[model samples]
Target: MGGERGSIVHRITKRVSQEIEEDPNLVLINKKNADQADYLIGGGITSFDTYIDREKKDNRKYCTKGVFVSIRYQLVDVKTKEIVYTEERYIDRQDTREGSAPHAIAVVSDDIDMLAKQIVDITRPHEVKVTERIYLVETKNKDFKTACKLAKKSENRRKAQELFAKVYADEGSYQTGYNSAVLLFLNRDFEKAMEEMQAIEEKFHTKEAQKALKRIQEEIEYQQKPVQETSLDSMYLRF
Candidate 1:
């Protein structure tokens, strides 16, 4: 798990172990119990990059920061010693702010849950049917109204995300800010979503945002770990 960022591998492994278990067919086992499991998931960071920029705006300094990470990993059938699935996943995130940049450690946080869930999606042999919905927020602004409509279309959601961001920036209201962050969370941009949610709480201190922020943070934490963990046996975490 050791790589450019000393602790990143550990974080990614923990996230991956927690997420991959979401697949109904798979249960993580301690790597020490390799003989007891049917498959294994392993990976490591291939490349990582970080950058920051600052701009002076109306006597205030605004900072923009970004992180890029690439990871290579594989899923192997334990008994057959065959590579079942493998991929080199690339993820990059940029945050432009009107003030201080996000913390250095926080900036480097990549969503390994995305990579792990991607693997689960690809490896899952069967599909389970489930119902879900993406809700829209109410806004008097015409642009916000348009965004609500655009969001209903799956592919147009990024466009909607941009609009939502604009509404949040312009209004700076709790409702707009909350909706913006919620959309990012739904889009799986956990880190940025967290940043936005925290901002809402800081500015409005509303109970609704506080509760939503807690739920978002908990999800980002993966129940503080997987639903089930076998301490002595070791859960399927590999780096």
Candidate 2:
């Protein structure tokens, strides 16, 4: 895999591997890990087309480039030797760009990323507990109250996160800020979490917030993957 087409092969493997590993029910392994990988995902470019529309106006040349790429990939159950899942994903991008070839290539990678996420969604999903401390401090902030209620159930945690973020914005207390960052971390929004943690450190300079920042950094180092899928599941009852 050396030519333009070959460039997509590595992207497909990498994107798919990362998304599949995010599933709490699956473990990702390669030559470096133990020989326990139970599924094989593979495929190639199913179809693609690229075109550059150029026009001359007054003396300057205008270019509107377009790219359409489709790739077909699959997940094969290794033990029983069966093709459990397969999908065809297509990406189209068109705009004036510095180069047409690179645009087309990037479109392929983007399409592969979308495909990988859909595969992750369809994989045998099992929810896992992610340990996080939500601040239940008595607050006048309505968002805080709503977050506490929503966080009681695992399925509502994502929505709870949005409210927690609002609480942090309204009241920049350490507890509020930490709660907000943990929600972002739980949702696997590491970049946003990092930003929020940095803000917390700058404002409060507290040790607890710093430690939370360190945990977030470790997760980023682990390839934007969660170290574990611990949950706030039913823990609100204890409080």
Candidate 3:
């Protein structure tokens, strides 16, 4: 868990471990016997890029500061010795607080939680399934104007409506399609995932959609088979 911004990353990791400890559902194995665990989720902040500029208000300099922490990690399968997942992300925070550790944490707490959940979800994917399903259902039924109003009035009715929403056949809207594409990309189906992303880009015309398109395209290109180089000796000499 060492990195350029080692201390902050360590703090975030410690907090995440504390969360896992407090959570009833997660089974955290002892470090000594981590090899016996089914999967390993590990990450640390690789770099912290920060900037500050003065904003003059009332003839006084007020600094507008920001930091982008690039976190990198890999998930490995204990039994198979396979790298199941890897990700690099930049978590950005913009705040009035200057270059101080306490201020950094204050500005980035939410971002830390969000990123921590991502790693934790990899550690405990099953726990996130229900949450993902709920999100998907909400996405589907979000445009139901009158129905959404009525459903919000009663908890039971809302739950029932959500359940009913899940049963509807998906017409595959933008969010749903993007989610599906991401799942495919995660599963290493890059070609189909790229197709889905392209379709989304054509429809949404958003920067996020364009980013997804770029990522999948990069993955696809990177995964293509490389041409073996031939040395002069190999070309001239007989085996």
Name the candidate that leads on TM-score.
3
lDDT of 1 at 50: 75
**Whole-model alpha-carbon lDDT for candidate 3:** 0.56
Q: How big is the positional error of residue 38 in model 3, measured in Å on the Cα after superposition?
A: 1.3
For model 2, residues 132-162, the per-residue Cα lDDT tens digits are 6677778777788888887765567789888
lDDT of 1 by residue, 67-97 (tens): 7877766556667665544446777877777
The lowest-lDDT stretch of 10 consecutive residues in candidate 2 is: 230-239
- TM-score of every candidate: 0.47, 0.44, 0.55
lDDT of 3 by residue, 69-145 (tens): 87765565667655565567788888873343334655677888777666666555433332211123454355433
- In order, the Cα lDDT scores of the candidates are 0.64, 0.63, 0.56
Worst 10-residue lDDT window for candidate 1 reads 226-235
Error of 3 at 17 (Å): 0.6
For lDDT, the strongest prediction is: 1
RMSD (Å) per prediction: 17.4, 16.2, 12.3
Model 2 TM-score, 2 decimals: 0.44
Please estimate how well model 2 matches the true structure, expressed as its whole-model Cα lDDT.
0.63
